[model samples]
Target: MRTIYDIEYLQEVTTEIQDWDYGLVQGMGVFSTSERYAHIELKVYTRDHYTDQIIWNVKEEYIPADLSDFRDEIEEVLTFFGNYLYALKGRREKKLVYEVIDGSFCPDTCMRSFVRATARALVNCFNKERFKPSPADLNRIRNSQANGLELLKSFLTHASQEEVVASLKNVSLTVDFKALFTENELFLINENLYNSIEILKKKEISQEAYFKKHKLITKYGDISQIGMAHLVLILNRKDLLPQVGVFQDEEIAYKFLSC
Candidate 1:
């Protein structure tokens, strides 16, 4: 018996695949545009016990110009292709898979055939289950999360000051900041966010200057640059979450949001 699976737009297209395991096939896709037509860029990859390799990097350049307007359809087509690869993970014959992918998904004409082909393939295998990352990947993620937590703790210990306390009155934090961060960290974050908000409100500083003025970035490295923005959105600027990129680290973001 065959079944159909609904595709999901899990996240913004990224070079890295999250939660990847050995022996699994995964792919990513993006919709791009030229003046004359829309293009769909798709890349598939696989990891054996030793190495990771790209199976194919394909671009379908003949999509109708108006196809870009149907963002959902683009996502659906790409996601169906993703689900097709998910079903084909262990069955992939490198030579045959490349040929199949090229002939079906990566053709020059358009995406209509690719969409229909992937949908039929998806129904044939009927699997859309996510695979867990390998043990090595799991360990790597754990270390990253630990390092990020320590970084946050260190930032709080060193950068927090008394001056930012006054600005706390104007900010209404959506999350229990106390639960996730110490008083000092919250104060520093509130101060930076307050200043950033003021800077944007007054339009007195360039966007570059606002980033430079962030307490987290000033004290820590550039990666921490996104930290203050995350804090701003996570705390008092919940309304702007839709418009901004909030999290830097995925595991840490999950933990922070869960809190």
Candidate 2:
């Protein structure tokens, strides 16, 4: 069975299909014109060699009108990250299939889709500020990630497509639409969420509903801060557990509920 979902404003997103894996995520209010460029949360699952591990992962994709070519460099940025994860896991090359499990309590809808290195990059970027380097200066602060986010942020700030493409030199990235768009029908969703304060700082919002929905602050480099954790404070609504996301600490839970 299949059903179509709709975003409140954009209706062309009305075309969608429900299969074994994805449920009804057609086109909800992900890309916000106001506060959030995009924001979404959903429980997910990943299967290991033996048992399955459920995870709460999100995709943070932000593009400003400044740089029209930001979309093209997505693949290179993600590829670097994909290489990074495999290296961390002691694997060398890119593998065609990666294991993922259902993160929700409900049964697997069997959404026929695979994850991407870029999606992982989105996770990294959504983690926090200072997560991605800001300056092109080689003597960047020590103990930092200097992969490709600095250039991404710069492109978003300047909108200089040529300059942004040029900045990719450091990471060996190029702005070509070929790598960014794929043939597959399934699209990756979800990314780490930002706070209200951070989202307000950027000069790009055009909608009011996004601000009302408690959307997190987001930027282009969001994909840069994936693996790192920020000194973030979570609020436990006591009733809003599922919406808040995964956390394995009493203090985090306590601090969340206290404030």
Candidate 3:
């Protein structure tokens, strides 16, 4: 199934430049993008005393299947901004203003190139794996440490017991649980798991309550928000209701639900 993600656009004035006078030159901006598993952000250019730069940001675990469509839209928007910057340069300065000069002060071609280059770079970044764990590795990690224990705790609450146990079995051979987790911690974790299973079987506790009770294991440290988002997407592959809590952006949650 195709996954849907959210995009956010942000614009701000920044003062990162220190050399050129903002009043005279009024050129030079950065363009950058940040990518996450469920959210993408396109940051607008900032102006200051020295330079101006455009920012494009994307946040996703994997590149969207509709990247070509997205790229076309992004390219158009960037081209518009690049043209705007070129115009600003021409209006503010006086040296051969209307002429398209190579290596000149903020030429139209330069803006176009910048926009296209930035778009391509952002696309490349999105395609690369940033923090996503492989299914086997994720299963092993979740069963081998305090951090993983807490995730398992939460997962058990959200997913079926059979599903959780099946995942654990899939990775048992690959992970050296004895080496990764101390016996005492493992004992406690096992007890918690068994107790959780019993409670779930009895249906005596609410899912939320059980999750909250076991979620305190290990302080839930170092869990990847992006990874969690990715997992949420995988779990909901059958069109199940999503149970994601890692994304700070509501748009991400909305997209997940709508998708």
Candidate 4:
């Protein structure tokens, strides 16, 4: 029954509120007000069981200020997370199949476990008959695998990790291990990948030779797979992968190789 008109009062109350160890759940809702800096402050409280923190200070003027608008905004955020969860589940359910086809589905142990868990949750949420991989799905998966391989080959020949990551910022991929892998794990993988690239750069070892030397390639079973894996690693390190328009189209992959 609470409405947006109460927001100004809530902001004043929040200034005196201290962090609670157990957290608030139902008492708070979405609230918004203007700040002295000419930015709007919006706070949205979520009903998640693990935490009850308000998403604060969203400085956009477009933010919802009315009850109906606030409901729509909340629904949009929920819908995004719902879709993300669904995709994560779909990816996890076919992890092994992806590994076989793509070579680098998830080379890291931690990431693999995370994918499995997420997939398992998805399975539990729906009927068993509802989730089945089709031939068309496999074909699309193969196409993505091939595209990733092409990008990897081009990257190895011409681009640095920084360059490749920056170029492909907006180019969305179906599988991403960035959320699963820890900083330490990423650093180790990147170090090994860099060393392999450095060896290749020296012209002492061929691509085949480099793959044989790298553990991830040997374990995962494809150089192209490793290349795709490296792309994900670069993405997780966001600062390393700034937005660039070079990877805006599929044709650019060939250009990368030609350069």
- In TM-score terms, candidate 4 sits at 0.19
Top candidate on lDDT is 1
User: If the candidates were sorted by their lDDT against the true structure, best first, what order would they fall in?
Assistant: 1, 4, 3, 2
Clashes (candidate 2): 31
Estimate TM-scores for all models: 0.20, 0.18, 0.21, 0.19
lDDT (Cα, 0-100) at 47 in candidate 2: 34
- Tens-place lDDT digits, model 4, residues 142-172: 4434454443333223334344444334333
In angstroms, the error of model 4 at 165 is 13
Q: How close is candidate 1 to the true structure, as a TM-score?
A: 0.20
lDDT values, one for every candidate: 0.34, 0.25, 0.30, 0.31
53, model 3: CA deviation in Å? 4.1
Worst 10 residues of 1 by lDDT: 98-107
Better candidate by TM-score, 1 or 3: 3
Q: Best candidate per TM-score, number?
A: 3
Error of 3 at 234 (Å): 20
Clash count, predicted structure 1: 0
Question: Model 1, range 1-259, lDDT digits (tens) per residue?
Answer: 1222223223321222233342334332222122111222233334333422323332222222223423334445544445544454544333212112321111122344334333333232222332223364344334434454343333332222222222222233213222445556556646554444333333322333443454333322232323343565555654432222333344544444344
Off by more than 4 A, model 4: 1-121, 124-126, 146-148, 153-259
Query: What is the Cα-based lDDT of residue 212 in candidate 3?
Result: 36
- Using lDDT as the yardstick, the better of models 1 and 3 is 1
Task: Give per-residue CA lDDT, model 2, range 216-254, as digits (tens).
Answer: 212532211210111122221233322333333545544
